[model samples]
Target: MSKGQITKARILHQAAELFNQQGYAGSSMSDVMDVTGLKKGGIYNHFKTKDELSLAAFDYAIATLAQHHRAVLRQHHHAADRLLGIMAVFSSFIDHPPVAGGCPLMNTAIEADDAHPALKARAQQAMTNLRKLLCHIVDTGIAKGELQPAVDSDVFATILISTIEGAIMISKLYDDPVHLERAIAHLTDYIDEYLRI
Candidate 1:
């Protein structure tokens, strides 16, 4: 990569963690400067406004997460195993997170709602993509006779996403990992006993 490209990536990486942790409203230009060790002009040269940086940072974070999910999902052949793989990825966050502050989708969704329209839209799109992926997996499973044909893919996708996101939020709020652990257990059971054919 070129010098400018490297610097911009560095800025995005640092800014993503800061924004995820402190949030868009809480993080300041100085904080970005501190994190990147770049002067005002250097930062402004790459991003015209804080909003631009926030948007880019969010994309970077989400893209990183999607890459991780793809890696985990690739390991499992069956749809049920793939679904459990998703749960395992989220459960792993209790100990080691892909990003600094936890799930970017959950964090951005909570903070961006009614505050940052662009960020909120980005978060919404991310969820939509996730749900679509889950639906496809479940649908494929049913077609392959691996999952019950009567199952509603959309409902299952929504429930899985909601359960995991809720668990992440509760675990973070209560400063306890057990909440996520229980949620993961329930999700595992749901996949194996209920969804599997």
Candidate 2:
């Protein structure tokens, strides 16, 4: 990477953390400057506006999450195992998160819903991709005879994603990890009792 590329990445990295932790509205240009140790001109040189920086930061955050999930998914060969691995990734967030604040998808979706169109759209696409990934895993499991043939991949994917995301939300809201733990336990039961062939 060139010097400019490295600098831009550093800015994005710091900006992603700040935005995820403090939120778009709550975080300011000074916060970015403070994190990146860059002056206003230096920051604006890379990003024309805060909105531009926010969109890029969100993409960076989502990409970070995708990378982590991909790594976790690679560890299991069985379809059911892969699904459980994915669940484990989310469950791990209860104690250790890839990023500081928690799930960027949930955070951005909630904060950007009515305010920022571009950020909201990015979050929506990230979620759509997540759903597709889960569906693909379910379909692969069915093909391998690891999952019930009658199962609807999309429906299963939706249920799993919704359950985990809701669990994360409630856990964060109450500052309790047990909610996430119980949710993952129930998900595991559902998979073993209902989805497994």
Candidate 3:
């Protein structure tokens, strides 16, 4: 990457971490500067507005997450394993994220309520994409005979998405990661019972 590109990338990545950890309100631009070693003009050069940076930061989070998950899923050929691997997004390993930044989607969603429409929309789109991915996975399982033919793929997808977001929300609110375990257990059970046909 060019020097400018690398610097912009660093700013966005660190901004995501700051936003995830301290939230939009709590995380000042100075925090991002501290983390990224970028000056005011350096940041504003890349992101014209805080809202723009916020959106880019969220996309950075999802891009990182998607890259990690795609690598993990590629290790397993079976649809079941791939599906469970996706569920592994909730495992205890995620509790203490290597990034040490919480889930950006959940953080953005909670923090942007009625405050930043652009960020809120981005977060919602991320959730919708996740739901669509789960539905697609379920469809693949069905085609591969891993899931029952009678299954309501849409409902299954909705529940999985609901459970995941709910768990993350509660976990963040309660300052407990155990809620993620509870949510993952439920999602795993659903897959085992209905998708393991």
- Best-fitting candidate, scored by TM-score: 1
Write the candidate numbers in order of decreasing lDDT: 1, 2, 3
| lDDT (Cα, tens digit) per residue for candidate 3, span 61-122 | 87877776677667866666777887776463356553456666667788998898888888
Model 2 per-residue lDDT tens digits across residues 28-73? 9999999999999999999999999999999999899888889978
Q: What is the TM-score of each candidate against the true structure?
A: 0.98, 0.96, 0.89
Off by over 4 Å in 2: none
Candidate with better lDDT, 2 vs 3: 2
After superposition, the stretches of candidate 1 with alpha carbons farther than 4 Å from their true spots are: none
Better of 1 and 2 by TM-score: 1
Across 62-173, the per-residue lDDT of candidate 1 in tens digits comes to: 9988988899788998999999988888887777888888998899999999989999999999999999999999999999999999999999998999998999889999
Find the candidate with the highest lDDT and give its number: 1
Deviation of model 3 at 91, angstroms:
2.1
Off by over 4 Å in 3: 92-94
C-alpha lDDT values of all predictions = 0.92, 0.91, 0.78
